[model samples]
Target: MNHDGHAKNSRTAYTHLLWWFLFAQGGVIAAILVPIHVLVQGILGPLGIVRVVDRHYDTWIRIVGNPIVKLYLLVLIAVPFFHFAHRLRYLLVDLGVPAARSVPAQVIFYGGAVVITAVTIWVLLTTVPISFG
Candidate 1:
């Protein structure tokens, strides 16, 4: 039916739009972070202020502790998890998984991603000490 075709088209379009938006956002974040990250590492390396081995742990703590950084991290985690889950669902469906099984698999994948995101946010919020308070 024409109506069914149109509805399916619309849903596909919307899903594509969502994927593009997330990809754009992730790309922008990467663009901004990559330069700053490189600059910081370069500066530290020359001054011998931080070695490569030490930098890994130090950078992790510093970023996780900052509120803005933590917010970006949360976004990064959530968007990628959902995006991958959606892609995985499509793959499973394409590989001949029944619609019934695929639907539940998709649901479980999304649910797990949500749970992991919540746990990550909670851990970051509680463990990081706020300097302003």
Candidate 2:
């Protein structure tokens, strides 16, 4: 619509959309899951106030060894990585790093999150048993 009757292809718009989507989903997932994890695993169980049944070490191992539990743990641990990355990326940008849509910044931050997520998956699958069978 400028003069050649064409729309400008915004390179960063779709990329930003993806990051924003991850940021929002990560925020929601973390908010819902993290507090529950902290309360059950850290506060309530340790205090002996709620008496978490799987609080024992063996039981904890058995519980986490379940496939569903592994998936849940993966989601819990991985999604938050993106949330933190997005937050940190924006924090730097907000602090005047001129990285509002910098590709390097996005690559670094998002790449860290991806690496951490892959490590988490590998560790879970290799170290944590699926079942004694």
Candidate 3:
């Protein structure tokens, strides 16, 4: 293979594809898991079909104390947020906003997702005391 500028451009496109692949993964995760979460936690639980008991502080703390549950909550919050950012970015572009398809738009959209993920992680770590003992 010749070392050429075209090859470099191809590599850049490949990298962009990888980023889109991650965005698609976030979208799929949100589409599949969030609806069930909302159905159970939002609609069904509220309707009394799932029977959500009001636990005291210690019991709630223990529930979040589990490592797996903490990770799940992080994914549940963060992935959907990326999906929202992706969709919102495209929506702005489609609505014909000036510079909506520019690099700064991408930064603003995905950066918002990153910020949300950080906040989610901070909240989870502060709230959940996971112990291996």
Candidate 4:
């Protein structure tokens, strides 16, 4: 019975570790890339510092047609989304939300990330192909 208990404990600990690991990865990617994305596209382009004059619909269509660009966009959207989920989860927990500290809370928050990821993958797979041909 004791050995069985130990095994269960180890598995639970491993699951928690996996959640934290994903959160850390998301955080790191968000910190590194999000600012650069915002600066270039949001700030510089709008301010005319980068001169995004040709950034019309057709230009974006061709850009998204490239599989590599699609993958990059997937990473850009998905990772930061997970980062937001992770941060929101902890923030709610810290703010003394009773439900936030529970297993269901983890599921609710991280499950949201999973759902977003699935939608992103689906859209990319279906739309990118259709957009190309």
Candidate 5:
């Protein structure tokens, strides 16, 4: 009965709510954290403008091997990834791509996010610290 002629879309409210929640949380976290991350990691640390713990490979390795830091890094990378996927999906729809709302589009966008998140976790898990013994 809806505009798609698909009987009001069988997708439940909770799924929509989940995506919206991730999108909103991702946006806020990205806006607050991404800029600082870029400034510190991308610019200052590499350029030697600031001496951060991550400036040295040894220190960086030690820091990243910590579970807490790994979790933080996952949040830093994964949250905005979902946010971007949702935003891009809607952007395509708004740009008159009628197929953007289709099941394939959902699979492509959200599935991509899921894949990337899994890869990030795998990489983080594989980061074994080198013992100085």
Candidate 6:
């Protein structure tokens, strides 16, 4: 039926849009984080003539423990988890699961991802101690 065909087309379009949106989001994060990470690890720390690993370890922990940085980390973790869940759903479909099966699998996968992300964000925000000293 034309209605059925249209519904399928709409679903396909939505799926494609979701993929592109997530992909672009990830690309933007990578563009920002990669350069910052490299600069901190490669250029600035080394220019200071300090051991890179020691500097990186200390700096990374401090950055992760900072409130603003932790917030960014939460966003980073959450987006990647959602992206992973979506990709896993497609993998399930490719493995020959029926669409009905795949839908529920996707739901459960994302639900778990959300719960984990929440817990991680909470722990990052609370468990880590911050000092201006």
lDDT of each: 0.65, 0.82, 0.77, 0.75, 0.85, 0.67
RMSD of each: 6.2, 3.8, 3.6, 3.4, 4.1, 6.0
Candidate 1 segments exceeding 4 Å error: 1-59, 99-102
Candidate 2 error regions (>4 Å): 1-17, 99-101
Query: Candidate 3's error at 34, in angstroms?
Result: 0.7
Cα lDDT tens digits for candidate 5, 32-110: 9999888988999889998888777878888887777888889999888889998899899999997989999989998
The true-versus-predicted C-alpha distance at residue 90 of model 3, in Å, is 0.9
User: Per-residue CA lDDT of candidate 2, range 1-133, in tens?
Assistant: 1355335553346766876787788899999889987988789988989977567777778877889888988988988888899888888888988865598888999999999999999988997689852
Candidate 5, residue 30: lDDT = 95
Best to worst by TM-score, what's the order? 5, 3, 4, 2, 6, 1
lDDT of 1 by residue, 12-101 (tens): 566557756765665565555557556666776657876653356655566567788778767766556665566667677789876725
Better of 2 and 5 by lDDT: 5
What lDDT score is found at residue 35 in candidate 1?
Answer: 70
> Which is the winner by lDDT between candidate 3 and candidate 5?
5
- State how far residue 120 of model 2 sits from its true place (Å): 1.1
- For model 3, the stretches where C-alpha displacement exceeds 4 angstroms are 1-4, 12-15, 53-58
Q: Pick by TM-score: which candidate is best?
A: 5
TM-score, cand. 4: 0.78
Residue pairs of candidate 5 with colliding backbone atoms: none
43-122: candidate 6 lDDT, tens digit per residue: 87779955554366676576666777667767766666666666667787788866825556767876766787788777
Using alpha carbons, what is the TM-score of model 5? Answer: 0.82
* lDDT of each residue in 37-78, candidate 4, tens digit only: 788778888788876633566675677777887787778777
Better of 2 and 6 by lDDT: 2
Model 4 alpha-carbon miss at residue 50, Å? 1.7
Tell me the TM-score of model 2.
0.77
